[model samples]
Target: MSVLIKSSLARKIVMALSGLFLVFFLGQHFIINITSVIAPETFNLWSHFMGYNPLVQYALQPVLIAGVIIHFVMGFVLEIQNNKARGLSYVKYKGGANASWVSRNMIISGAVILAFLGLHFYDFWLPEIAYKYIENNPEDATRYHAETVHKFEAIWRTVLYIISFALLALHLLHGFASSFQTMGINNKYSSAIKTFTKIYAIAIPLGFIFIAIYHHLNPITH
Candidate 1:
């Protein structure tokens, strides 16, 4: 079991599975956030429910952190190994002519998205979890749910979120298809699967962007 964990193929498999899990989690998050655009009151209610759910928070928080670390480390390790294996430098690219630009620059987009994640945590998660919940800021905690609505109402914050979501869409465009291939799902039907995945990759991120922009333009009354 230890050997398998250390093996390259095994690492890729684990990364792929964890990545897919994160993808699903992102979908859930995006859906929840979209509620703010539709009905701020409903969104505040839902956010409060999530914030107050100790069981859900305790169970998923650590799991999410672990999955993110594992997936990122595995991806970097694989990239390094591939680079070392190809000792010869190429002046021109031969393959990937048919691949989308996002497919080729997934690492770059992923890095950007990761940086945005840090900012996101700083802007929202830290206040919600660390300051409000951990330090027990009763005032902030009380307004936590409505705080999200106000945060998105800020034009600068909403613009930043829109940019981050755009990078996320690019990252997912390639990541969705590549994760399946890494998990050994590639076959004759792989093309169809990839096409569908790309469509979803586009839609979900656009949904988040639209909501962010909408909320920014139309401030919700708290």
Candidate 2:
């Protein structure tokens, strides 16, 4: 078990599993947030439940954080290892001949995604944290709606969101089907997986961009 974990293959496996977990999380998060546009009450109620639910708060949230950390850390490690191996190789390697641009530049795309995530946490998650834990504020389900509205009220913030989501789309375009490949899911269904991944990569980011645009155009009337 220890030897397997220490192997390079093990790292890829862990990254693949964690990446898939995060993909699942992204879909769920988008679904929940989209409710703010169509039904304010529904969004607020679900957001409050997610924020305060004991199972989510204590169990699932920690797991989610761990998954994010493990996936990114392993990605960085693998990239560094690959670069080092390339440097030491006597034969020159032309990576672009084999893989697409996005496949070759996963590290760069992942870095951009990490930077956007930091900004996102600062703008939305941090304030929510302050309201919930630090300030001991009462549970107001509707607060998240206004918070999201205020976030998109700034044209710059909305632009930032669109740009970040665009990068996210690029990242997922490569990552989604790659995860399945890494996990040894190559069969007849592999083509379907790739097709679905491409659709998901495009649709989810567009959905997020839509949400930001909607919030920017239709500010909350408080």
Candidate 3:
């Protein structure tokens, strides 16, 4: 394990795999979250199950957190190592001559996304933990939808969500295609894969933005 982390190639592979895993989780989360806007009852049912499921709460949640840590930490390590290896030559390097703006500034986009994740965890995860574990409150299966809607009641939060998701789109624009490349998936399907990734990069963030705006405009006023 230590030896694998020491190898640059191995580190890239690990980062790529972890990133792809998070992409899958993101898709699943989006699907569930979208239901909150369309079908409140369904959203409540699914949220209740996810919140109480031992497999998710105990096993998958920890693994997901670890994957996020590994990907971000490895990204920072690789960026630093790349900069060091480039040294003085990096000063003369013209990023635009070869790479796209999105590719060149992944670190900036990634940092924004990391900050957004912190906010997301604080808004949702911490409260959920307090409700279920620390406070030992009984589960209320029907409460999820109202809680989700209430979070978007503030315009500031809605705007921040849109901004964060915009940066997330930027991050995915390059990261998604690069993950496949890092995994050495260079076959005839590569073009199709890139096309799908581009759509996903744009669509998922837009979907999240829509969700935020939808709830903000249509608040649960009871």
Question: Candidates' lDDT values, in order?
Answer: 0.75, 0.87, 0.90
Taking all chains together, the TM-score of candidate 3 against the true structure is 0.94
Across 1-222, the per-residue lDDT of candidate 1 in tens digits comes to 455345868877887798899998888887778877666666676777777677768888788888888877777776665445565312222435675666656667777888888888888888777755579755422454456667786777788888888998888888887889987786799999999889988999999888777766666574
Q: Write the per-residue lDDT of candidate 2 for residues 1-222, one digit (tens) a residue.
A: 456445778888888899989999999999998998988889889999999999999999999989999989999988776667567421234465657777877887888889888999899788888998999999787777887778888898899889989989999999988889888898888999899999999999999999999999999676
- Prediction RMSDs, each to the true structure: 3.8, 3.1, 2.7
Q: Cα miss at 64, model 2 (Å)?
A: 0.7
lDDT ranking from best to worst? 3, 2, 1
lDDT of 1: 0.75
Best by TM-score: 3
RMSD from true fold, candidate 1: 3.8
Model 2 shows how many backbone clashes?
A: 0
Minimal lDDT window, size 10, model 3: 84-93
Model 3, stretches more than 4 Å misplaced? 1-6, 88-93
Better of 1 and 3 by lDDT: 3
What would the per-residue lDDT of candidate 3 be over residues 1-222, giving only the tens digit for each residue?
455345878878987899899989999999999999999999999999999999999999999999999999988887776676666333345675678777867778888989999999999999999999899998799999999999999999999999999999999989998999989999999999999999999999999999999999999899
* Ranked candidates (TM-score, high to low): 3, 2, 1
The weakest ten consecutive residues by lDDT in model 1 span: 87-96
